[model samples]
Target: MSNTNSLTEHDHPSVLLPLLYESAGHLLSSAGALTGEQLRAASLLPGWTRAHVLVHLARGADSRVRLLTAARGGADLPQYPDESTREEEIRQGALRDADALRMDLETSLSGLLQAIGSHPDEAWDVPVRWLGGGRRPVRGVLWSLLRELEVHHVDLAASYTPADWPAAFTDRELRATVARLREDPAMPPVRISADGGTSDLSTSDRPGPLVRGAAAAILAWLTGRSDGAALTVDPPGALLPRVPAWRR
Candidate 1:
């Protein structure tokens, strides 16, 4: 999750590109279990249908491809024209038939894979701007794709759940989310503990409220994907700070 290692083997295009591919495969498999009619039903994300989630996932891959392609060829590009345009694109695309939606997803994933595969090693270090105006090496886009695929796969409201996430992904995301909280002055300084484990996400030396749960459960709470009602908060019944929405 510490994607700042632009020139390191960890964030290398060769490494992240394949991870994104496997994640895409997992997302596509979850999608495969849905019927065309089911696509019209509501997803875990409020006001979003299963089709909406699928559309966004497909377009997201294309967006990453644009960023990586520009990095490889040394051309200037933006992931989307603007937020409204991106939403509108997803809005229109969501109305497509299930077959067409799946096809578009596969097509977009292929395009991104090809873009990553064709890149030279040196090109991976070229700086690219993300939609939020933050910039990182081209390989950062691959890490972005990982969160998208994994999180949205669960948001599809199908078979995948937070518990379904691989232990490595869960552990990494937990650390990253904790780091994000630590940097935010407005975020409460709470202590997060893995049940029976030593890992703690605390900002200050003086520990605050203790939120105890498994790694995946704790992550879900931190990411705003879960309310953490199931987790045990120390002080016997104290309320945890309302976590701000997860950064996109």
Candidate 2:
């Protein structure tokens, strides 16, 4: 599904909000099926386990609630905590069995859904700063939260992959992540291709060589993790100077 086509003005919190809830539900349910030992098994993310992943999901859901609340003009919420704190909380709290992780996820998901449902329509009009430092409409925030749940669900790599991600979800995230990277001064000037299309990403003010790759692959690479390996660039030196430290 095209990013623009999937999200419309009318859908508001109704469409993406429920999808976020349902996606988290599916992930937690998958976690529930794992054995206690399996729940403690290591995951693809460096130094994280299945329990850590689930705990992070739950904690992330709570953070999103704070973000939404801040968007709606509540007193400043803490910035989404850093990854170290997130992993530490998960590591410390996830010592128990699989059942505990599942329950924590379900509780967090429930609270998030309830809070989203309680927002007035005008709350959707509020402006918010997104992760990676960009302004997004409140509806965009909702869509972003939905994308997070779906992407991280795949990140769990329990029963899902990029191939299994909902097309609308991938499209939205790919577009948003790309747009954000384009605006970052620290990142490189590159060309991206995905869904059989290419986007030239370079600064007119800081003209330099172009880096070319599949948009999906580029987006994945930019996000610091992607399962696919289709990306290829020409005259590789052209991109060497602009590659960000994060990508290195």
State, as a TM-score between 0 and 1, how close model 1 is to the true structure: 0.91
Q: Residues 148-240, candidate 2: write the lDDT tens digits.
A: 666566666687765666655656566666566666777655555454544454433455454455554555565655633456555563333
Where is model 1 more than 4 Å wrong at Cα?
1-7, 196-198, 203-207
lDDT of predicted model 1: 0.80
Task: Give the Å shift of residue 27 in candidate 2.
Answer: 1.4
Best candidate, lDDT: 1
Candidate 2's C-alpha runs over 4 A off are 1-11, 67-88, 127-141, 196-218, 232-248
lDDT of 1 by residue, 34-130 (tens): 8999998999888889999999988988988888878877777887778888899999999999999989998998888788778777777788766
